[model samples]
Target: MAESIPSDSPAVADDHHGHEEPSFWSKYVFSTDHKMIAMQYMFTGMAMAVIGGFMAYAFRMQLAFPGIEVPGFGIVTPANYNALVTNHGAIMIFWVAMPVLIAAFGNYLIPLMCGCDDMVFPKLNRLSYQIFLLSAVVLLSSFFVEGGGFGGAWTAYPPLSAKAEYSLTPLGSSIWLGAVALEFVAFLLGGINFITTAMNSRAPGMKLYDIPIVIWMIVIASILFLVSVGPLIAGAIMLLFDQQLGTAFFDPARGGDPVLWQHLFWFFGHPEVYVVLLPALGITAEIITVFARKKLFGYKTVLHTTIATGVLSFTVWAHHQFISGVDPRMAHVFTLTTLLISVPIAEMMFVYIATLYGGSIRLTTPMLWGLSFIAEFLIGGVTGIFLGASGADIYFHDTYFVLAHFHYTFFPIAIIGTFAGLTFWFPKMFGRMMNDRLGKIHFWGTIIPFNFIFIPLFVLGMGGQHRRIFDYSYFPELSMPWMQDIRVLATSSLLIMLGFQVVFFYNFIVSLRSGEKASKNPWKSNTLEWTADSPPPHGNWKELPTVYRGPYEYSVPGRDEDYWPQDQPN
Candidate 1:
């Protein structure tokens, strides 16, 4: 059972012993180490999240109190409002969600959990972050450019996005497209790295079934992104050419169908939801199983369901096009596929619940987050059924209902899932336990206001309030006092949610500096990562672990301990 495992290279050994300590630049900034790179991606993504949140604040303030000078930001102009909405969507999805859920956690956890010292291609991993960083820089720089940022929205639908005259930001539009394209390329690289490393590198005896769910989820997500992103990248290039060169790929007057871009975008776009979502779901799975002190119910079922979800994701992209005048038969096909895709997701959620049943459940902050993900995301899933049906979507299309459904879904995937993962792994990542008291405070603060924020949007959407309206005063029907009152409620709820994030940040900083010192295996779980140091070193372990059992070996009969470590020999 104690077979020899691969050790770090001589160069790594020399750096630790024979050579001097690494400088700040080499150690933290441009390091080829996967963990450092993950830190870089995580922090960068967090910073972008703050920017995205501020954008939400700015735009929501405008919606709640039109023409009023917002604090921190003065009067929000029409262009400013559009840019805020557009970039907020783009940054949160691409910059924040993908980076944190996939790149950051994927990079950090894959190698460590897999019991390898580093990624298969460490330099390539570093290069991926560099490209991602450059893409972010390019995106932010667009806002300060000659025409301000692109206001064509995150989807960048054609006619508006393809034509400079319509978008009013020739340079900004092109730069935005370019930034998005570059970001895809970076992920393409990172995805390849994740897939290859997970496939190739594992400790001895760690069979396919023995691998952690988080690793599988990240790898599967990488595959989904790889398959789906190509068409959008091509469409982005074509859109760029239309904007800069004399092309009409998406211009109706020039014989190019604008809806063609919709096909290319949503084809990737719908699956993009699952791409981020799979990782978040995987994170919740880890948290739930650990805190509940139970074996994951139907682990293989979850795996198979995830794969089915990915396959079905491609078929459902056309649902977003139902209201775009797509062929009714095609819409019907997509509608069926859209509803079908939800089955696997719902199955995974049920599997989690089954795991929690009759188990010793701990109400830790991370567990609360994990449980809330299931609850909140269930709302998103159920609401999505309305949008999935072509007939219902025809009424709900482009309304605040769609917006509310989207937020309900994505808020869980990106924000709630992220917090769940962060809190669960805080000790492993930082070698210190986060303050549970503060964590619970922050959790309730965020969750309560969150429901308040979007539930009203669903109501407003049902009332036929258009999502894109800068101000509703012009429309007498929408300007009704009740409608405006709902808008204010949503916006005020957002402010409270944003305000509570302060508690999280304070808790994070204070805990990082001086928190309770944590020992290895703080969670006492079965995953291989727990066998290593609290904050594992350059070569994760003095000797790499050889797996002996599956990850979730809890409550095995005849043993005093309820939990079993994967590497422990009987």
Candidate 2:
């Protein structure tokens, strides 16, 4: 400032940077850098995952060995059991996996891949992370309060979530309402930043066609969030008012219909699955194309399928509420919408499988995760069709079968997809290759144990076991002995799944310092990020790249190399 250094000079950099590292508060606490914000989201999300996972482990201990004392955690009473179930679902689905997968990855990768200096509004991006953190803190804080966290389940269906008298603690329900509302606001701002940056901040000459599928999936998902989140936000406010101000928004006793909450919640909830799944699917698409040494088969088809799925997501909300006592006539329409939506999803999977055919496949860690996603998501999607059938749902609704179907879908999209993204982008994220041996071990450990955990849930569901019940002692007709056996296997599988993460964590942390140095284009794929520096600098590209090919132009018949970068000139 004394000499008025040029703004674009390397020494001068941007507005904030000068002779010294910005003050500790500006640098670490309120930083606007997308990368730092991403780290914030990642660490926060991981902490929440641990909390949520422990909750699941606690609940499973009870399920596997009923009346068992949970070591340092103490006994699992019924009220405590309900609290665990509700908070576990809320934290894992909303606060943990969703933020990590969508917000964290999306924030970190979108700017770098698109070749932008930073998000359009970097401060807003930072604010989003802070809001998410605040929401998590508020949510967790409720547990220590007088009434405990909300016990109405993640769905927060009325009469259950609405009335303080119905809940164990009078304030539990309101605390939950406040926490979810804050979380929604966090996502909304994050979504806005994503959409704005993607649409406006691409590197010079970078076209839509050249954009990575992962970014596309995120963009589409962001749009879905923007459109879908509003109704749920409105619903949450109404539910909160019903609890505090004695309004009848969702309170039947006060003239509000309890069923209204189900409609609003599922409206956002169903598409929310795709909102999480699309990014994972996009990761699968990117990893598969890079490792197969082949262009994505039917790239346009896959794009259309993603867009179609986003639109179709809004129409199928009622499928989740079929058993909530909605009108029977509307149920048929919902069932049709739910079952039919699977068509596009199935088509996308077909494209992935078709892409793998006759390709020179490199069985790297990312590819393993991609292949696992195909197998797991197929099982999840197909089983979802089973639940989509109104007839089957009438019997299976709220049963362990439904639980299994969702876990298959959820775990694959969440765990497998995240793993794929981590492996595929590890080089760029850390400037080094993850330990291949450790990675392979982690992959195998996750897939095998994951199957064991959820498949038994399906078996239990089909055997007529209901969900949310703390004890199965009374249900003697439901193959109690087999349920016991399944519970043991499931618990064992979960412990294994949880243990494998240690290997992943070790590999990730150690590799940052000791792993092999990654080449700029280690995977030999034709994406823009691969054309840039590994662990790209503050300003992504030294020179902005110009695009001339589709994202997956691998193994073209006459190409000199097996792959072509999207930015390479024809």
What lDDT would candidate 1 get against the real structure?
0.90
Q: What would the TM-score be for candidate 2 when compared with the true structure?
A: 0.95
* Model 1: per-residue Cα lDDT over 1-570, one tens digit each: 112333354211112221247888888887878888998999999999999999999999999999999999899998998889999999999999999999999999998888888887676788789999999999999999998999988999989988778889989999999999999999998998899889887888999999889999999999999999999999998998999997999999979999999999998998999999999999999998999999999889999999999899988898888878778789878878888887998898889889988789999999999999999999998999999988899899999999999999999999999999999888988999999999999999999999999999999999988876788899999999998899899999999999999999999999999999989988878898888888888768888889899898888888999899999997
Which stretches of model 2 miss by more than 4 angstroms? Answer: 1-25
The lDDT values for all models are 0.90, 0.84
Candidate 2 lDDT, 1-570, residue by residue in tens: 112544444222233433355688876678877777877887788788888888888889888988889865678888888889999888878897779888988988887778776777665677788888899989998888897767667888878888888886678778878988999888988998898788877877778777888999999998888898888998998988888888888766667788887878888998899899999999999898889887788878999999999989999988887777778888899888888798899899999999988799999999999999999988889899888988888899989998899888888877788789878888987789999999999999989999999998898988889888887886777646877999889999998999898999899889989999999989997877787788876556767676676778888898789987777777
Per-model TM-score on C-alpha atoms: 0.96, 0.95
- Top candidate, metric lDDT: 1
